[model samples]
Target: MALVDVDLALIGYGGATSLLLDALDRHGVRGLRIATVDPVETARPHRTWAFWTGPRDAFDPILDAAWSHVDLYGPGGAQRLELAPMRYAMVRSGPVFARADEAADRLGVQAVRASAAALDDDGTSVTVRDAGGAAIVRAAWALDSRPTAPHRPGRTFWLQHFRGWWVRADRDVFDPSSAILMDFRTPQPAHGVSFGYVLPTGPRTGLIEYTEFSPARLDDAGYETALRSYLKLLDLPELAVEEVEDGAIPMTDAPFARRPSPRVVRLGTAGGATRPSTGYTFSAMRRQAEGIAAALAAGGDPVPPAAYPRRHLWMDAVALRAWDRGLVAAPAFFERLFTRNPPGRVLRFLDGLTSPAEEVALMGSTPLLPMARAAAGDLLARIVR
Candidate 1:
């Protein structure tokens, strides 16, 4: 076994870990030795990350694309909407990977390509295997961003699985400046919701995705069939698919531990940073990275932030509980909220922003009977405990 020492050790180099490195460099924390291990040859490559932003986002320097217009389509039809003061932006996985790697090289941080085997409870140490045998490393703090196993005893768990096709056609069939928010004309699962999302990258190129927020995943043929149906429904002709991107995002009531131990901190999805309501984590990742970098620089043991705001968690719990009980329609719940609230406000709410007053008003847009019953029952159980 080989052993090395550093100030920090990172497990993965996804959005969260990469952003932290960038922040640390910007703070002029020079010559800080950090080691990272990820067997994955490159960072995110096959996924697209989209987030809602107020003006002048912190990570705008590396933002790959942005759009100002938003549209929502329901069973009724397409509703065109505009956000004057807010923007919806997307960052591709490859560019994020490149930016992180470039910063690491310039900052002289040690980047190791290895798979982690285990970590000691002492928390500051880890064991990983490279091409050779076992290698042991020690740091003042270690952050693991790998997805944690879900373990919510009685609650149901579902994954939001999606397949996006980057397409270019001979003719323009997509709006270059607007995001197709959701087309709920598709079939819904008996237990959950499903829809299509489109983000126009350019006049001739864009990403069209078929997504499902259900407990189960579709077979290969099932996803293909769904995509075919969606394309047909939108009256898109035989467009060549430039690329296919697919992945899964977990949604569970599982209590993901923020700090696994005093010495080990978790980040990203592994730290339960995924928002329960919408499964959005890009912006949350930025927040987590900022906190982590500051703590590391100050020589304090770092701990992950609570995954979501308390209010947002409560709202998600209410919605998920209602979904589990078959009391509310997912499409209708979203439709009413979007119809009543401005697109920016609704997006912010989904992205875990809003005042208490705004939250209450947004909740009121829904048929309250189902969510109220769920919240009441949840509170009663808490009281009993």
Candidate 2:
């Protein structure tokens, strides 16, 4: 029948929209009608996100914990890395959603609880339709965060999958000062690479996970086996498992369609926020939300910017080819990276923030010959195809 008309409508109210609303609130933008289309409101989050950034950001208030340094464990030994200008932060999704809801209410943003099945974009406005072909809402612009299965046809794909446990022990077992970014001491996977990640909230409390980068995800029992094996490496007392978090992030070289139509744009992972190599997405989406907020406030186009430059994407594609083809030994590869290069440089490079010369230096630290060959092969394969 009638529609909930607004200036802008968000198809999903997860991290991307929340961050956008948070930034808009911070910038004191007002007088525009906004609405969010989501099927259900989340009361609790079974997931956690970990990201590294320089300085503070909008989500700092709800940050569960932060670490100024991190431990990188490899075949040789463990090295304590000082993240000077940057700090690693963790945020649970439940609190993040709550914060966004509060902001939406204050800004008078409406919520339509319906699944957006289709978006029809005219030159001036977009109409969101549900599965039954009913108009759910209409807006001048639509930012769709809905994610499809990441298995894109005809693209190189990989999975960054993990199962983590929030555990506590009576004994002070963890060095809480620095989080463990990667522990390669855990048994390596037969196909891809495997590592242990630890984020200690305290001496006896932390989230420990067994992570793998491979073509497919492991089953529940497979994850349990790997996690238990990793836990044994840490000398501790009987553990109390407080929570469990499990998920798979798609790592792909497929170019995402940012604009489905003139008035409809994509956000979050579907918009190319996840890095193909590391599966880190929060930081990229966070940066983009801020940009979108600024543009809307300044009476400018609010399209989300490219998450990373084409050159950076090309480099990541080459790395993926190498890893997928078994051209480089990942454990020793990453081991030498952290040991030989400045930790900040490596972290920046992962974010695609490093300069060309710096990138060359970093590439020099890897198996240069193998990577160069991989890059050449990747180029030729694309050309012939």
Candidate 3:
């Protein structure tokens, strides 16, 4: 068969691709032949995407829930931080994907149900193949948002694994106004950190999750055990689980190749959208999508901008190193951070929007000795590498 030609080819129709498609549509960039390759038949499974941003965000239209007050619990006590003018928002994947599909249909973008086999870029055009080694399509430019290269042994890497259950109680047992960002009362792991996250949708319904940042993933049974333990700690009434969601997100300071080739660009987590410390990607992915759309609109090469700010990257590296080396206690570190600094400042820092002075102030809130040691060690490791 003759090779099919398109203006652009998107390998995976996930968060990044959807955002890019949305941006393209908003900019009135239409009538271009585009193809999306993915194996999933329908929309992706039900998962929640959460991020902290100002009161008004581009994604507010699709937000399922938002909380202005977040609670943090540790050995010290509980701290309720008010995020005025900024709120933490959560959007269900089902709705977001449905919206994206609608946009794709309106924009005349084709969806192919096949896994990508190979990608070849030769300056002028890019070609992609299916798993059967058959030519899928050729395009002027292709954005490959497939899974990233595997983490090599000895590389500083961590996995943010989580299992969440949507539960309904027999009676009102949750405060819908406040979300529990972290509850460290649960059993702590030997290494890394573990916490419970709660997002109450109603007085009797909520999503509770057991999340961990560790070198390795936990089994299904392990997660269930932890969830049971957390529920017991909460001492809520009998509950019925309506749904369950599980996922593992990569958290690393390792470099990701943004431009694998002149014509093929990487997107999403593959392009380093995952924040090293918090494992947040949606906001960063949105920023990257906007950048690509702007570049294309300007008739320039659509290479995505840097995934994250340089200073933010440095802070993430240092924090990851500190956690990996067990230089500081996870609960204590977080308690200090939330207790010492204004909630908005900490949230802004986590979102990579804080200025240099704000960042310095945030750093000063933490234990100086451990941070200094971690910074020095990270510097030495980078120098020797």
Candidate No. with top lDDT:
3
> How do the residues 8-104 of candidate 2 rate in per-residue lDDT, one tens digit apiece?
8999877888878877777777898999998886553457888887778667788878888998888788888888778899988888777777788
Candidate 2's TM-score reads 0.96
lDDT tens digits by residue: candidate 1, 273-339: 7887677888888778777767666865556466567878778877877776788888888888888
Clashing residue pairs for model 3:
none
Q: Against the hidden reference, what TM-scores do the models get?
A: 0.92, 0.96, 0.95
Q: What residue pairs are clashing in model 2?
A: none
Encode model 3's per-residue lDDT on 46-122: one tens digit a residue: 77889888879777788878999899998798889898878988888876777677878878998777888899888
Model 3 TM-score, 2 decimals: 0.95
By TM-score: ranked, best first: 2, 3, 1
Model 1 misplacement above 4 A:
42-44, 58-62, 123-135, 151-154, 297-300, 380-385
